[model samples]
Target: MDNQKRTMNTDAVISIRDLRISFGEYHVLRGVDLDLYQGENLVVLGRSGTGKSVLIKILVGLLKADAGTISAFGQRVDTMSKKELDDLRLKIGFSFQNSALYDSMTVRENLEFPLVRNARNLSRGDIDRAVEEALENVGLSQTINQMPSELSGGQRKRIGIARTLILKPDVMLYDEPTAGLDPITCIDINNLINEVKERYNTSSIVITHDLTCAKAVGDRVAMLFDGQFQRVGTFDEVFDTDDERVQQFYHYNFVE
Candidate 1:
């Protein structure tokens, strides 16, 4: 097969078609179709009021779509049984924009909680090993015993990532991973994301308003506007397409 056909033939880990979501009278997403390829980092960008966060929630089954097909990891999610959703979640992980760490638990325990809850067959030693490996992956082995309150924002975010990593999820969704971090820390996190992708072959869907972060980590970029995807393409293709809305957003946010 030619490169274009080969690209098209590769099955997507996450696929949505004609997805429509509404909150009573307000439409949040409209006929949105998206496909995320294996190990591809696709970034969804949009203005604040757009449904970026809602998109994240839907992909992870936190929110149900009003209409459409939602499939992830070869399973149709739109009508999955509760038991199936639980099984599917074992193969997918979501890191919220807010770290959402449990303040009462130590970082190690926070990471351990999911593993213990989901992988009931795992012994205590196996769970500890997994937690240690996750912490090591995030470069936070030293902070395993520390509380979320004792860590900085960036550290807490890493801990959240560690928690997600402990699940060994096949697809990872990151909502605004770079938000509220200093420039250096943002770069650090971006590099860490790249490292994780390279090491684990983790497919990712990242939603963010951070153009710099998007450009740094995205394999392809999709813009959500007016309850639909305005454009979807490689970073260069979409950013340089000369589309008025994209140009406006780029210039308004990125012009120095």
Candidate 2:
């Protein structure tokens, strides 16, 4: 494979080069390179424990890479200070795999938390409007007064997305958006991922092992294997090859 396609380019909303991390003797990511272009959904495909989730954490400075270059919005994430990282993170929205909603807070309060804490000097009206708009975007406006426990699995996921959307981040990072959901719910989340890009014009990196989610949401796909991206292309392009590793992924396309 020619290296230029995966190498960092100026137009990429997020670019990573030679990203490597390890746990004592076990190297999780040997040397990973990826580029997320503007307004494009780049799916990072890998089996569980391949470090897909770790890569996402590294992007947001939740975890540090042993060695690599991570650039988001033209800023070097690996070199950023705490203040700088915090500033950069405000522009990136991360939707966790399990939809990490606060059980103690109502849907409205959960949505308001980020804005109230991050955005200053906002009157009660501003927060209320933002919360309402976000809930509406995810088609969960009616659940505003409800608790996280009261919502279904899919509804909670939508609310998670809504909370992220409320911040109006320029980039979205979704970690297994379709994990642990029914087929119909997965389709809805897939549709929502596409809808988000169109509606917000935000570039995204969706990390998942689910091939169905990849084909539906990814403008391009990159497969992480053996601690590196061994395949990078479209849904068909990546899996069309006869490589046993890639074929194995295609054969087990459904979410577990």
Candidate 3:
């Protein structure tokens, strides 16, 4: 896909400034600032325990920030009420690290669960259509009746994405989408991420340690170190920097 042509209307869908979060004196995020623009993928690269997951949790309002301002779609997330936050979450899709599909549910059932809960007003026919469309988006329409256990890692990841897509979210938050998958499967997942961006025209934040995944899916890349962004730029711009720390983190030699 031609990302240059796809890039239109540079508007910020999500913005964070001076964001600070701490857990019992241990600071996870310290004065972090980020902006996720519409129709673009912003990949955050960081080692484990650098608060990537915590950042997403705060964005979704799962965890409160100690200090900072977070605004999504022009509304202040930090100041929103529980009801408002819950309503806002519907517009955001979160793909967890493990795919997080319920083992007891079939693929169809899993896809339907979100619609049944969030889209209560939809008719049965609408719900079925939504499920089918979501599955077809991920190219998994045939696995409708299959259980989560019967699917491969890649398949489960696709189902997880389908479940998220069922809501037709305006923003997507992906936490380690390529984790625990084989290299080939990782590439497939990365391709799907790109496809989703083009198809939905949604803004996305992809948190990952995998550089290949970052390069494949991210329109812009941000590196998190010491509770702040060490650098932010296009993949090549950041990767080609002269900073030793950045080079060391990316395993400089391996990236080429």
Candidate that scores best on TM-score: 2
lDDT of 3 by residue, 1-256 (tens): 2434233223679988878998997898998888888899999999999999999989999889999888899888999998999899999999988899999999999999988999889999999999999999999999999999999989999999999999999999999999889999999999999999999988999999899999899999999998988789999999787887888877853656
| TM per prediction | 0.94, 0.95, 0.93
**Alpha-carbon local distance difference test for all models:** 0.87, 0.91, 0.90
Poorest 10 consecutive residues by lDDT, candidate 1: 1-10
RMSD (Cα, Å) of candidate 1? 3.5
lDDT of 1 by residue, 84-201 (tens): 9888888888887888999999998899999888889998899989988999998889998999999998998899988988888888889899999998999988998888789889
Reference-based lDDT, residue 197, model 2 = 96
Better of 1 and 3 by lDDT: 3
Candidate 2 TM-score versus the reference: 0.95
**What's model 3's overall lDDT?**
0.90
Candidate 3 lDDT at 88 equals: 96
Tens digit of per-residue lDDT, candidate 2, span 1-256: 3677546677888889999999889999999888888999999999899999999999999999999899988889999999999999889999999899998999999999999999989999999999999998888899999999999999988999999999899999999999999999999999999999999999999999888889899999999999999989988888789898787777777532
TM-score of 3: 0.93
